[model samples]
Target: VAGLPNNFVFAQTGTYTFTMVTDPNNQFAECNENNNTLVRHITVTNLPDMRILSQHIAPSKLNPEPGEPITMNVSYENIGQSNINQQMKLKLLIDNIPVDSVYPVNGLVTGGTTTVAIPASWSSSLVGIHVIRAIIDADDVVNEGNETNNEATRSFVVGSSANLFFNQFFASNNIPAPGDTIILTARIGNNGDLATEADVSFYYLNDQLDTLLIGTSAIAVPANDSITLTFPWKVINNSTVLAARITNASELEFTYDDNRATTLIGGPPQVTVVSAAACTGTDGGSMTAVVTGGKPPYTFSWSNNASSQTVNGAAGSYSVTVTDILNRTATASGVIADSNCCPPCTKAPKKPSLLISGMSSTGATNKFCPGDTIIVSVKIPDPTACSYSWTVPPGTVLLGGQGTDSIVLALDGNFAATSNIYASAINTCGTSAIGTGKLNRGAKPGTPGSITGIQDGLCDVSGVTYVIPTIGGLVYNWYFDTVNTATGAGIITSGQGTGMVTADFTSAWVKGVIHVTASNACGTSGARKMTNLKPAPGKPAGITGPSQVTAYQAGVQYSI
Candidate 1:
């Protein structure tokens, strides 16, 4: 906690002591357990030991100009007995209320001085007494024995310097032409106390003004002193009048002088075109005029100038004589206005329209496999004496005849291959619209091949076997015909065979017929059939002789 009251104000100069006490509620539990209260002492003395030693508010008055910087210096001093470690802060108050801090208080030592700059916008109003107060706060003291708080306040007035003045001026022409140099001069002076540095720029306001010569030094003038500077300029071309003026000027901390002035320089005499015209085809054009100097009310006349030629538009150079307002006459020459003749109108030959006659594949019977080569030809209409250009689809391998109507193509792995032909004919005019033809490769269908040697029999017994036959490029299918009505007929079996066959049956007495079919990619072949059967076994005859020989003992040798 601080030792001073929150709102304490000191009026008289005296030494004041304060004591800072630690919070009583916070206690050390282990060390110094019983006596935990801590207190520290601080002292503050109200003293008027710091003051504003010197202050200079620039111009002494306010000038209402945009973008001007105002500077003020508040020189301060530390008159206290003890060294002060606190910074001497400066605050600018408009009406005893702080608006901005010109210099913040920090890291300031005793018996030192500093300056603060206040911008021009801070005092932008008209001429008036702007109470600018500089307050110095001594918030830090290094000596513990001297308990004193030092502060000081001072006020100054800002005056107005609205009158414009020149600071530094010069004139120069980087490059001067013959007989066109102009002599220029400038003056720099200050009406205010503040010192300023500025640039006096020169520019050509009128094209007729004399061109500024080279090697002109910029002149600098001190406050309240005027310097008359002069330089030469050059005039080029036939301008009647020339002008020069000051372009820019500036001042430091006090005011800015944007004052400008222009002067008229020398130029060439007057040149005039009295009359001008364009001539008809084959006929020549003419113009006449009178040249003049020294100005107004000039008269003009031409020698041997034809009015008919003047009336018609013609192209060529002509001359004339002119009289100035001052009664001075001279000869002037100028070109007559001419009409540009367009090139001779020749009718452009009409472009022949592209016509597609027919598109056909060059392979035999127009048949092709997936990766076979095929040629495509597109017939273009015979446009007499006309140029033609042919175009084909991308990836179409051109074996021969490119830029013509026909191009050969190799089929790709895709299902279909097509060629588009663009034929255009060009003549004297523009090229015609393209005509295209599409050629497609034929697609072949897939078919199953022949199935041969179908046979069926009872289950679990050897029976007739059938073989399924197929073409080299075809597939096969096999089906069996059964006689049992309870079970389903046409039982399919699994065996892909070309010539050999074998079969087995589950039962001995069952019989059936087996059928086979085969097919290829184009079409299915005819069905083949085989029959199966289980024959009955012959009965055994009774035992006769051998039974009778052994029947003596058996008595009744009946058919045993």
Candidate 2:
């Protein structure tokens, strides 16, 4: 059958008339001309349905870190009965805003699909629930079975941010005299995994706790690092509390409870704070003001520029002047001292020790087979600032972790059976005592020397006494090889771990071989064969030679 082909699409659901004319302009005259003139009505119920197959963030996670680079992966497919003859558009949206529009290079047929990836707009400051949407056939270029399922939306939150903290708040000069500038420094520490930027604001509080903003600084702090910001503050004004805080961080509200510190000015406030015991080492000593001799509402002024009752100062001599409400003044002097204020900060670190992985506890006995690599580490407290030294035995290769407490030792088949590993800890102060770790190598043992036994004992009824070179701490197992019409099951009578033994070979063939192996914690070695073992010769052939040779009868020897 043959027919003329034409391309057209019915957009509406209702059916319409269709007419065909053969050579309407007399372009061709054929035998089927009358049949081509016939008209037919066709129903257009099947339509193309373009739908979003999938839309998500690549390297998907429930919550990604702020400013983390990410891309949106989206795909669309035609799930309808009919194929689309024209290209369609795909639109991507972020938070309901159209950010990207793409077109299919070719028409989409039934079950045809395409995918696209778009880089997302991410910023360190944007930290919250976000939206990503993928819309297929956005231009409605292709007639579909359903249009409602053309888009997909996803929402995700930017992670738990880095923990930024104000670790240090101090000043260059706590007791600044008249016209002296106090350099205030704030140390910010990030204990989290994300870097962030923030503004650190400095302030000061007067005697009445009246606060004043000194200045603000914008700085960047990296993950697990710290940065210091400084601000020059002048005018002690008799005494005032100086402090700093991280108020704004990446345009996000920080959830730290202790983000702010106040009344942190250095040096003790004048007579306002009554002296207690002198402070010892670094901070942590407390003092309270017990003003009884002054008039009502007394005001204290300190050379350290402290308006509050308490302040911080290095170990040294301090003086302050106090005034009553009526303007009467008095002065006092005190000293802060500590023997440990600075003692060269001494003491050597503890000795280095080794710990093997998979062991129950440190210093536990372990076995290492031939061609085995073992992870040996210093079983000591971590985060300790120090170095280490390790010493390995002969025939052992140190794989790594040298010049440190831990190490990797590769023991070969010919490695020594027993040895010790020496190590030590070195610190700024001094080197620690050398430590020791034992190695019980399970290397293959060398073949035993030729079987040594008394010639007469070899055939004795009491069995033969055989021995091999004794290795201090290994177990020797002896066995016999099967031969002839029978076999000899050598019975070891004594000295198993002692390396010396007596075996009874009375029940088997003379052609059998006695083999022994050395074993330790690691495992057993290969066989060391001892051949020519047999019971004592049959009573020396009834002592025929001895009968002819009597005592003092020379030349009386005879053969049987």
Question: Which candidate tops lDDT?
Answer: 2
Model 2 misplaced regions, further than 4 Å: 1-158, 251-254, 266-560
Cα displacement (angstroms), candidate 2, residue 137, comes to 55
In model 1, the worst 10-residue window by lDDT is 355-364
Backbone clashes, each candidate: 57, 6
What are the models' TM-scores? 0.21, 0.23
Q: What's the TM for model 2?
A: 0.23
TM-score of 1: 0.21
* CA deviation > 4 Å runs, candidate 1: 1-182, 202-216, 222-225, 232-258, 272-560
Candidate lDDT scores, in order, read 0.43, 0.60
Q: Residue 476 CA error for candidate 2 (Å)?
A: 94
Per-residue CA lDDT of candidate 2, range 1-560, in tens? Answer: 22322235554344677787756887887766566576787655456677774333332453567777555667777777645546667777767877767766345677787666654544344776667778777866554557688887766557665667878788787556647887877778886666888878888765455677878889888878998788888755534556677866773322354467644333332343444443232332334344544333455455555544454444455566666543556666565443232223267767666676522111234656655567777887323324567788886788765554567788765667677888877655677888888877544455555556643334324435778776544567776675522443455544444456666545343545667787654566777776655554534554355544447766765564
